[model samples]
Target: MNGRMIYLIGPSGSGKDSLLDSARDALAAQGCRIARRVITRSADAQGEAAEVVDPDTFARLEAEGAFAMNWYANGLSYGIPRVVDEWLSAGDDVLVNGSRGYLPEARRRYPHMLAVLLTVDHHVLRQRLHARSRESAEEIEARLARNAGFAETLMTGESDDLCLLDNSGSLAQTRERLLKLIAEHRLPD
Candidate 1:
């Protein structure tokens, strides 16, 4: 199978990370490589491999040609490091559980990238954010507003450049849908 990059984009609290974790596990069992990102955001304080770095350091690295692409989201700077090119060069399908806003830039850089926009219902998203216990009521409201703004930017009609997945239901359903898409696209070996 030809190497292709899959980039995941969706709003905050949209289960992108959880779904990507499961997808990565399944894909690795099949010998595919899943890519990780570096972020300037603070760690989850719950031991997630956040690759945490201060803003200044992240900026320096970006200036030094360390990142393949860099963008800001939810008030944090995120970067996909240049090492991803090496993996792509070696014929690995790079699975990136990252922001949706990166789609246009990634497409310009990696012509074969498959951009998937995962989504959850507004109620489901609010529930997820509440369960995190990381935000005040006011902060949650602000976050939801920001997500709405991002959603607007992403609401264009579909094309080969975009794939939309609604994830407001069970994990099994979401995984099944994802697997079917990957197979249909011949993205995984």
Candidate 2:
């Protein structure tokens, strides 16, 4: 059986990292690999475990075909490494921290991949972004606008492959839902 790619996409303050952390812990005993993305931002900027690369470095890597999927979003560069194919071929479910802007291209490239869109309500998103303290008030507002843009852009294309999980209420609830989604796809038929 071919391994699967579970692609996760969400807004900046949607608790993606938190959800991913819980998922990793929950799926630790399973044959799953959660991908660490290559991002053109500081390592600690968003509290996500990503390879921090400079703009020039990111551009060079992109030219070198080091990424399976890559895109520019919110003034930053993000990429999913090419090793994903290897993981999938080896029959291990690979979970990737992905981008909304890159989904169309990503779907074109990995049609079998499971796309998970994690989200929260507008007020909750605002509160979470402010609580992170990583972005200024202006940046937070801009991020909200970007979230709306992503909603419009992501609504098209592959509805069947898309799974939505609202991360608004509590971390445990969202984590359980994510785990079930992963298990549904990860288990052998």
Candidate 3:
């Protein structure tokens, strides 16, 4: 059978990274192949655990057609490298960490792609961003406003299906729910 892609799309402070980390380890234990995304943002701002890629090199890779899908958001450029296509082509499902703004384009490209929107209450989002402290207060407020509008568009988009993973609960609880969904849907791997 052909493989499919499961994309996790959300705002900056919606706990997308944490949820993905937990889900990745759990899915790996069950034999799933999760794909890591490359972004142009500074590694320091992204946190200590993220893989680092130079923005210039990422751009070069894109120009050389190394990415299956790529886009810019929030002043940062993000790309799903062609290596992901190689994996999916080889019958391995790829769990991609992505931005909500790219959902419509992604769906258009891969009609069968499973898009999951990670969500948290606005208050929670504000608090989380504040904790991250990567952006100044004013910048954070601007992002939150833009993120709100982007989230709405993603939620209303026409696609095969849209799954919402609420991230307000404990990390373990969220991971459990994600695992359940993957199994129930028989998402490719």
Candidate 4:
């Protein structure tokens, strides 16, 4: 059987990176591999452990068909390496930190993929974004508003493969819930 794709998406400050980091080892033990994304950003950027590449390099890679998935968001280009295809074909589940706007395309590509939406309370999300210090207060507020709208849309037009995981309180609790969610979706042998 082919392995499932867990496409994780969330707002900027939703703790997707943190949850993925905390659950990495456990997920690996359960045969799930996290795909390291290639992004057009600095290596020292304070977020996910994505591969940093210059715009030229990213263009080259994209031209060469090195990515199974690619999208531009927040003024940066992100790509999921095509190696994920190999892992999936070998029966190893793959999890990707994915884009909310690009989700429809992702779902089209992997129809059976599980869409995990990591969410946080509005206040908690605001605090977290502020703590990052990346965006101004106005930008953060705008992000919060967008997030709220997106969450509402998802709740109303939910799909069978979509799952919502709240990351507002404790990372430990969220990690446990995430593991359980993945386990529940695992394909039977």
In order, candidate lDDTs are 0.77, 0.85, 0.78, 0.92
- Which stretches of model 1 miss by more than 4 angstroms? 44-48, 157-160, 187-189
Give the candidate number with the greatest TM-score. 4
lDDT of 2: 0.85
lDDT tens readout by residue for model 4, 1-189: 299999999999999999999999999999999999999998777998889999999999999999999999878999999999999999999999999888889998988899999988888999999999988999998888888888778777755668989999999999999999999988878
TM-score order, best first, reads: 4, 2, 3, 1
Distance from true location, Cα of 79 in model 3, Å: 1.6
User: lDDT for model 4, on a 0 to 1 scale?
Assistant: 0.92
Q: Given candidate 2, what's the lDDT at residue 26? A: 69
Of the pair 3 and 4, which is ahead by lDDT? 4
Which residue pairs collide in model 4, if any? none
Worst 10 residues of 3 by lDDT: 43-52
TM-score of 1: 0.87
Least well predicted 10-residue stretch by lDDT in candidate 2: 152-161
